[model samples]
Structures are given as C-alpha cells and as structure tokens.
Target: MLKLIESLIRYEIRQNVIKERDYVYVRNQLFNLLRIEPTDQDISYESIGYPSDALDPILDILEEQHILDGSKVARDLFDAKIMNVFAKLPSEIEDLFFNLYKKDSKLATDWYYNYMKALNYIRSERIEKNEFFKTSSIYGDVEITINLSKPEKDPKSILAASKVKSLAYPKCVLCAESEGFAGNPSRDSRDQHRLIELNVNNEPWYLQYSPYTYYNEHAIVLSKEHRPMKINQKTFENLLELCEQFNHYLFGSNADLPIVGGSILSHDHYQGGNYVFPIEKAKTLDSWKKDGITYNLKKWPLSTLVIKSKSKEALIKKAVSILDKWKNYDNADLDIKSYSDDTPHHTITPIARIEDGFYTLTLILRDNQTSDEHPLGIFHPHADKWHIKKENIGLIEAMGLAILPARLKTEMAFVKSYLLTQKQLPDEALKHKDFAQKILNEHQIDKDNVDEILEQAIGEVFVSILEDSGCFKQNKEGISAFKSFIKDELI
Candidate 1:
C-alpha cells in the first residue's frame, strides 16, 4: 500500500517537473487543441505540429481496466495520461510532440479542461473560509501594541489583586492565575540583572524574561491589543528585520493554542530571542543537500524533512500549505476534532544553522490539543509517571525536554480543590476530568487497576480537595512539592 502511495506521489511530481520544463511547447499544443488563437501565430507556426490521434487506444485500455467509462471520463483520463507522459519528455522531444499533435488532439483539449477544473477546485477551497480577510483591504492591515502593566511590588497588595475570579478554580485565589505574581520577582531580577546586560542597549526593541525559560534569551513579543489574529506577512518581515538587525534567532508562539507554552494575559503576541542554550537536543539522523535545500531527519521527531531552504518565499509557502492540509484532514476526521481549535494559526521560529547563510525555519502548528496525547503531559516528571518509567525518562532527560502528560491531573487537582472550598466543581471542569479519565482508561489505567500507583495517590488527593477543603489544607506540603516538580522538571 505504501509503495502504491509513493508511485502516485512520484507521478504527481513528474507531472509538475515536466510542465515546468516544457512549458512553452505544452502551452502551444494546448491552445491549438482548444482552437484558441495563439498570441503570436509566427511563433505558433514554428512550434506547432500534427496531432497524434492516440486518445481512442488509451481510452479503450483504461475502460478495460475499469478506471474509465464510455462517458467523457474515458476521454478525460486519456488526456490526463497524455499530458503526464508529454511532461516526462525532454524539452526538444516535448516540442516535437506538441507540433505533431497540436491541432489534431482531443486528448490535449480534454487534459487542459480537466487541469483548469482541478486548479479552480483548489482555489475555491483555499478561499472558502478566508474570503473576508482576503477581499477586505482594511481587515488585512495590522498594528502592534504593548501593555506594560508591571504588577505591584508589595506582596500583600499583589496577593489582594490576585484574588480575581476564575471559572477553572474559583475558590483558589493563588492558582496558576498567580503564577506570574509568584515568579515575577525572580523573573524581574533576571531581567534587571542578567537579561538587560545581554540586551546590550538594543534600542526600543528590548528584552524581557520569558515566563517559560526552557531556553536562554527566551522573551515574548507584545502587541498593544490583548487579542490578535493570524501572524501576517508584515509581522514575519518585521521579525526577519529584527533577526538581521540583532543577528539572533527569533522563536514565536501562536495565540488561541500555543505550542511553545504561551502564558500571556489573553493577549496578542510573538516571541523570539537568542538560541545559545540547549532547549531540546536530539541526534541528527540524516542530511541531504540539493538545489540550496537541505534535508534532515532528526532522531527526536523521527521524520524526514528539509531543515532549511534558500528561498524564504517558497519555504514559507510550502510550510503553510502543509499545515493547511493537516488542518483540513483534522476537520474531516471526527477522532481528531481537537486538532482544529475553531481557528487556524501558525508559528515561525528562526534558528542559526550549522551551514552559513541558512536558518532552520521551524513551522509549528498551534491549536487547542497538540498531539494525540493530552496537554497535561507537560507536567509528567521522569521519576513518578508510569509512562515515563516504562519508556525510560533518561532518553528524554538526556534530550533535555519534557512531554505534557496525557492525563489532566494538575487541572483535576485544581478543580477538586476549588470545589472543596466552593461546594461544587464547575460543569466544564467535571467534563474535562471525565474526558481525561476516559483517555486514561483507554491506556489501561482504571480505578481497579491504576496504570501508575502514584497517579492513584495523586488522584485521591485531587478527589479529596473537591470533597473537602480541609484535606487540601492538610496536604499543602504535597501540593507544594508537586508544583515544584512541575516547574523544575517540566516547564
């Protein structure tokens, strides 16, 4: 089955390559077949040839193979095959084919018609959901804005301000909502002392400490608005300008659903900085160089791909197209509904390559759910989690990265704690817990046979918090330890 798929793909690539090579001859033959006036008859007279009446034989063979019917289908299929075959020929021979069969070929005419139909279908689909943005001039324009509301310094005042209500954990005043406040001083100290020195007076474009500092020089780019849509060409070009000006690589995350752990205040933003420190390291598996494009397969991702390209325009276009295809496939598949978060988004990360004048254009797809695994995998420590134990965390730790747990233990704990204090869990929280539990069960973890013995203990604490606030108050030390582990080993 895989070989058959590869053959189909090769056929498509061959068609494209041929069209690119013998474009002039193909165009002249196509025009003659359609009885259209040539732009220059002198050139057409020189290029055109007698047509080959081979459509009938090809159609008969296809019909025998059950790939065609007596209707226009047979004729259409034959024409497509002819075009594909013509495309594979050398330019000189392709010109001869065109001149020989130009006026006499119904196959070429049908092929042209079918090709236009396919092109139209593609264009229509691309514009179906994006017509408004594409058609409107004003809607496409964008401006960046930043909000610099540094939190209060006094702990009491900050704690008081952190008492804002949250649907996820209404009763917990210092939930993840207070993450910024709890770590703000350390972050600020790092900014004022270490990060500022690194900035080296880089002008208005300054540096800030990233909330998640898995990598050195990690910082978020703020827009004035709290909400923004797609990362447009202007933002990308400006980011590239910054890259050139600073001579540093920039990495960014998308809103709605961020892959690189976005934690802003429901705001529009981008992120970038230097890549001096190692975030995730994996062995390079294979490398290939061709036409200014470098292909690489890394051990971590276990996938084949071009790591960098000379043509930025082509690279971006291809990456966006692949992501668009993935989104379309996700939308069509019921099992992968979570992959599409009711919005389309992209993240472009620039990396300094080993080869000069080239950079790794990392294209990250952003949405509510990342992989098939649950997002909570972010908190799974190597020592405790059963999955990590079974898989050997040494591999991941050696790579210097973390996986978000497929279970929602942290979120569950938060909800249960809130419920114990407030008397009831929110409907949404309960639903998420149920869904997460279902996934756990599918992985063979159930109440009777817990997948991880530790998870059961953690689950009991979560249940206790929902049932009685006194339980959470008694287990404060355990909660602190778990949170600390999450901070150090995961995020």
Candidate 2:
C-alpha cells in the first residue's frame, strides 16, 4: 500500500496534476484515508501507463483488508474516495479553467480534459477497451462502438443494488448536485468530479466531461436547475451562446420526445465535443436563400435542415420559426402526424457549431407518434434492426455515430463462428441468427475477412436505422413533400 501511495503521487506529478512540493501532504492524505501509519522508507516510482496502474492495486488491497467489499459498486465508491483526495478543489479548478479560457478556449478545454483524465475522473484506461470502428457507407464513415466501458455487475452486487432504496437528493444524474457526491450502490460515485460554472445567455449552466467518452473530449453542459429538455427559440439562442464560449466544439441536444430523445429526459443538457461526426461531412442535396440565411437540405439519412448565416440572431429567428411550423406539421401522404388528438409528436435533435465564419445549426426532424404496426414510434429503429440497436436515435446517433450495447462484443463472436461453420447461435445470441445469415448470403466468407464483413454489415444496418428514423424518405415523392413544407411554412 505504501509503494502504491508513492507511485500514485509520482503518477499525478508526472501528469502535472501535482508537484514535488506536495509529496508529503498528498501522501499523508492517502495514509489517513487508508488509516495507516506514515512510512519513512524511500520508494521509487514509474508510470505503468495509466493512473489505474497504481489505483487498481490499491483498491484491491483495500478489498482484501475488508475496507470495501469485493463488488464493483463498492470498489467504484471507494476508488473515487481515493482519487478525490488528489483532485483539485472545484473552486481551484474553476479558477484555473477560466484563467486559461481568457487566453484561448481550446487551451482551456485541452487542459480540462487532460486534468480529468489525470484524476481518473474520465476513466481513460477503461474507455480505451471499448470496441470502436468505422465503416464506409453511402452517407459517410458511420461509427460503431460496442461499448464495454461500463463493467457488468456481479450477481451479488446486482442483488445488493436492487435491495437498496432509491434516494432523490440529486434529482437526476445530470444535476449540479452530482459534483462531489458520495454515490451508493444505486448511484455512481462522483467524489472526484468537478463542474465549471458558466452563464449561458444569462442563465446558469455548468460544464463537465463525460466519464464514458464516446468521442474525443466528450463534454456535458447542463442547466443549474432540474428541468426537462424543451427545444424552443431560447434553445437556439443558448446553443449559439455555448458555441461562443467553446468555439472549437460542436454542441447538440437530443429530441425532447420519448423514443427519440436521449436516455436522460428529466434533466436538460447538451453534449459537446471536438470530434466531427459523419453528418457534418454530408453534402448539400439542395439549398435556398432567404432573409440573408441559407437553408440547405442535407444528403444524410435523417431529415435534416442546415441553417447557415453570418448573423446569429438571423439563424436563431429562422430556426425558431421552422421549429414552430414543425410542431404542427402533418402530411398523411408520408404518414407524418404532428399530433394524435392532444399528444404532440414532432420535435428536432438540434446541433450547433461555427463553420468558416458562418454560424451553423442543423435540425434533424423527429417524430414519436406510434402506430399499431410499430408500437415503438414509427420513426424509431424498426424491429428488424433491434438485433443491433434498439435504443433511441439520440443526438449522437442522429449525427451518424452508433453507441451499440456492450452485449454486441460477445454476441458478435458467436455470430462469427456461426457464419464460418454454420453452427447454431447460442440462446444468448439468437437474435443475431437472421442477421448473420443475411451476411452469409451476401458475401463469401473466410476466416480473415469475416470480421470485416460483419463490421460493414453492422454499418449498413446503422444506415438503414437512420433512414427509418428519417421523417422524409430518400425518394422523389418524399423529397417533394419535404420541399413543399419548407416553401409553404418556413419560407
């Protein structure tokens, strides 16, 4: 434990989160946490690659000593306890971030992201284990990631978590209260977490890095208050304001309706990151100019309207007008109904960024109304695509990046064997049998190329899924109908 403590301090120093002057102070803090005596023996340290190198073994020793149970939940809680001791105070971090921001926004974010990783708050080591790949498709290079960052809970831990009563102190995971909160079995530990408070369009907001980074520098911007996500004129104004604050990042939000919105609906938030999604690469299918703003129809699967202008106010005004029209839009010919009786069905997954001095806002039209044939929203990923992804096509996926379930990692292995040997899939992967067979019929299979074939097939499935979510089909009639709406309502 002493050796690990020395190594952790050295690692943090190497990462620039700490310095040589604070050696004794940091070591004493850890010793107190472990309830151990101070050690006078000199220890040498080296980086074994990541912070987890020193932290994981320390956590294991704590479990062996019965300081924490050998369960994922317990280990998670205690490890955060250890890391937070080294993390800067929220105020210190905020001060440093703003100081850097005054010079350059990119430098500020770069430092912030590195600091979060250095403190193990971003869990960089585990996120690297996630299965990530990109395959070329008609739209662009569609990204598929079989997420494996989240550890599978053991049955004992699962049972314990199930028995714990729920508490609502934080209200939701995205709430401001999550910072420095000591999580229980039912919640995740955020002891090492910090939030940088910012004002967006005169309203309080906080910025934090996502622990599970699907892309580079994945960030969450959340409201200070607990409120549901609602896209309005103010949403456009706020998005533009956020972009001004983080000029190099793209900010977006999921649709505000069920089956098309993000997993978190109770709390309002937007995700921003430095990575460029496939949707941004899509070409303009057609374009029109009005009121000094250029509106382009994107050639992507999702029904997207790209609003571009030099004036921020002009972009927001036009976007809000389009949004208002969409709320009441209906076209029986295309099976799009804005509402069924009193329940509304139309919304948009909106993305904002600055491109070549032009403020750009992309609105992907979404509807959540269900029919008897497809109870899970007519625009959702259909039943055929459920073998891969059934979750809502949130803002990220609408941008052509698929965050697949962790189960795909194992299920695809079984699928590969079945594809080569004609072996029956296990009960666990039965859902993949038909999809795998389709792959067999489409391409010649061999050991070296089966994996590539399966990956491309998954990419194709993701494309079709996006097409299904599209309010306008990519056909002549569908395109015509879409144009009519823009001409009649928006123009």
Candidate 3:
C-alpha cells in the first residue's frame, strides 16, 4: 500500500500535475484518506506509466481491508476522492485553460484532455477495453463500439440507490452545480470534476468532456441553467458560434423531442468533438444555391441537408426558415405528420463544423409519431431491429456511429459460440437467436470467417436503423417526395 501511494505521487510529478515540493503534503492527504500513519522507513518507488497502474492495486487493498465496499460504484467514488487531492482547484484549472488558450487553442485542449485523463476523470484504462471497429456500408463507413467502459451496476448498489431519497440540489447531471460534488448513492462522484466556462450567443455556457467518450475529445457544451432543451433560431446561432470558437471541432445537437432526443433533455447541451463522423464523409447528390447560402442533399440513408455559407448570419437564417417549415410540414401519403392532435412531432438533429473556411451545418429531419402497426414510432427502429439496438437514434448514431449496449459483449460471444458449435444458446442470449439465424441464412459461416461476417451484419443492421430514422426514405417514391419539398422551397 505504501509503495502504491509513493508511486502515485511520483506519477503525478512526472505528469507535471504536482511538484516535488508538494509531494509530502499530498502524501499526507492520501495517508489520512486511507487512515494510515506515516512511515519513517524510506521506500524507493518505481514510476507508473498510467494512473490505474497504482490506483487499481491501491483500490484492491482498500477493498480487502474493508475500507471500501466491493462495488464498482464505491471504488469509483473513492478513487475520485483520492485523485481530487492532486487536482487543481476549479479556479486554478480555469485560469490554466484560458492562459494556454491564449497561446494556442489546440494546445489548450490537448493539455486539458490529458489533464482530465491523468486525474482518472475520463477512465482511460477501462475505455481502452471497449471493442471499437469500422465496417463498410453503402453509405460510407460506419463506426461501432461495444461499450464496455461503463461498469454494470451490481444488484446491491441498485437496491441501495433505490432506497436512498433523491435530492434536488444539483437538479440534474448537466447542471453547473455538479462541479466538485462529493456525490451520493443516486449520483456519480464529481470530486475530481471541473468545468471550463464559455460564452455562446452572449449567454454563459460550460464545457466538459464526456466521461464515456464516444469519439476522440468527445465534449459537452451545456447551458449553465437547469432548463429544458428547446431548438429554435437561437440553437442554430449558438451552434454556429461554438463552431467558430472551436473551428477545428464539430458541434451538434440531438432532436428536442421524445423518441429522437438524447437521454438528457431536461438540460440544454450540444455535443462536439475532434472526430469526423461517416455522415460528414458522405457524398452530396444534388446542390442548389439560394439567398447567399448553398444547400446540398446528401446521398446517405437519412434525410440530411448540408448547408454552407461564409456568412454565419445567412446560414442561420435559412436553417431556421427550414426548421420552421418542417415544424408544420405534413405529407399524408408518407405518414409524415407535423403533429397528431395537439402534440407536434417534427424536429431536427443539427450538426455544425467548419469546412474549407466556410461555416457548414448538417440538418437531419426527424419525426416521432406512432402508429398502430408500430407502437414505438413509424420512423424508429421497428420491432425486427430492436434485438440489436432499440434505443433512440440520437445525434451520435445519426452520424453513423453505433453505441451498442454492454449486453452485446456477452451476448455476441454466446452467439459466436452457438454459430461455431451448433449448440443451444442460453436463455439470456435468446434475444439474438433470430438475428443469428438471419446471418446464417445470408452467409456461410466457419470458424475463420464468422467474426468478420457477424460484424458486417451488425453494421448492415445499423444502416437500416438509420434509414428507419429518415423522415424521407431513399426509394423512388420517397425521393420524389423529398425532391418535391426541396423544389417547393426553391420556388
């Protein structure tokens, strides 16, 4: 335990997070947290390449000593508590971020991202274990990640969380008040968390990295207030503002309605990152210039329109105009209704980035109306595709990246074994039986080829899922209908 502690302090010094002068001070803090007395015996400590190298061993000892409950949540909470001692105060981090920003924007972001990982706030070690790969499809290449970074909640932790009374102090996870929060059974610990402040459209916003990063430098730009998400002309303005501020990054928002929006709709936020999605790589099938802005219809599965302009004002104006029109637009033959009774159903997943010195925005049309034949929604992933992914196709998946559930890791292993050995699947993996049969019917699977075939099959399903999210299909009738909407707007 003492060696682990010494190694951690040395690791921080090597990372430049702390100095040699502060080693004794930080060491005493750790000793107090672990309830251990100082040792006069001098110990030589070897350097650790990563924070988890020392942290994992320390956590195991603490668990064995009964200092922490043997649950992922408890260990995670305690580790954050330990690392918080080494982290700079919120004000100090903010000052450092901007001071570096003045020198170079990329340098600032690079340092901040590394600093977060060094603090174990981003959980880099577990993230490295995620199954990530790219697969070819008709609409460019789609990315798939079998998310294993998020630890499954044990039954006892779930029961304890359920028993604890929920508090309203922070309101929600995205709130600015989450900074430095010690956390409870119902909340994630934020002791090592910090937010960098920013101004968008003259309103204060906060920036933070997503703990579960889907892509490189996956970041969340959230409103400072605890407010519901509403997409309007201001959303476009704000999105463009963010893209301009971080010209190298792409920013986007999920639809602001149920069945299409992200999991967190109560607090307004936009997700951006350094990575370019498959949708961005898609080719444009048609183009038109109107009102000093250029609009291109993409050849992807979803009904996406890429709007480009050097003038941010012009693009925002036209984008908002299209948004308002789509809000009340209806097509009876296609079952695309703007509203059913008093509930409106049309919204958009908007993404923005800088391309060749021009500001660009990609808007994906969305609808959430349900029908008798499809209880979830006519445009959502049908019951057939739910075996693989049934969650809302939000901003990330809409951009041709699939964040599949953790169950797929275990389930797919069982599926592979069944296909190879012709053995019966366990009851828990029965959900994939029909999918496996479909794959078997389509392809000849052997031990050598099963893995590649199965991954490609999953990618094909993801393409179909994105197609289901498209308000306008890619068929002749659907394309004509879509072209009609474009033609009408042109007139």
Candidate 3: where is the Cα deviation over 4 Å?
none
Query: Which of the two, 1 or 2, has more lDDT?
Result: 2
Off by over 4 Å in 2: none
Tens-place lDDT digits, model 3, residues 1-491: 89889899999998888999998899989999988998767767888878889898899999999987777778888889999999999899989999998987778788889899889899888889899888898788999998999888997678768877888989998999999998876789999998999989889999899887989999999999888898899999998899878877899998899998899999999999899899999988789887678888888888998989999888888888888888999999999999888999999899999889898999999999998998888889988898789999999999999999999988999999988887999999998898898888888889999999889988988899989989899888887888788768643
All candidates' TM-scores? 0.34, 0.98, 0.98
Ranking by TM-score: 2, 3, 1
**lDDT for 393 (candidate 1):** 21
lDDT of 1 by residue, 1-491 (tens): 12222232233334343444454565556455434466532231111111112234445655676655444423432344343333332344335434534553334323432332232211222222221110101112111111112222455334533553433321121122221121221222110111111121242332233432333344444443334434444444444444543444454444333432233425444455454322224344455565565655333221113357666655455445444443443332212233345553223222222225554544322223333353432221212243212121211121222222323334445444443343355564554444344444445443443324324334332222211211111134533432332233322
lDDT, residue 2, model 3:
90
Estimate, for each residue in 1-491, the C-alpha lDDT of model 2 and write its tens digit.
Answer: 78778888888898889888888888889999998988767977766678889889988998889987789988888889988988889999999999999999999999999999999989999999999889988777889988899888887689879988888789988999999999888889999999999999889999999998999999999999999999998889888889988989999998899999999999999999999999999988889898889989988889988999999999999999899999999989899999888999999899999988999999999999898988997999999999998888999999988999999999999999999999889999999988998999999999999999999999999999999999998889888878888877788
For model 3, give the 10-residue run with minimal summed lDDT: 482-491
Residue 365 of candidate 3: its Cα lDDT?
93
Estimate the lDDT of model 1. 0.34
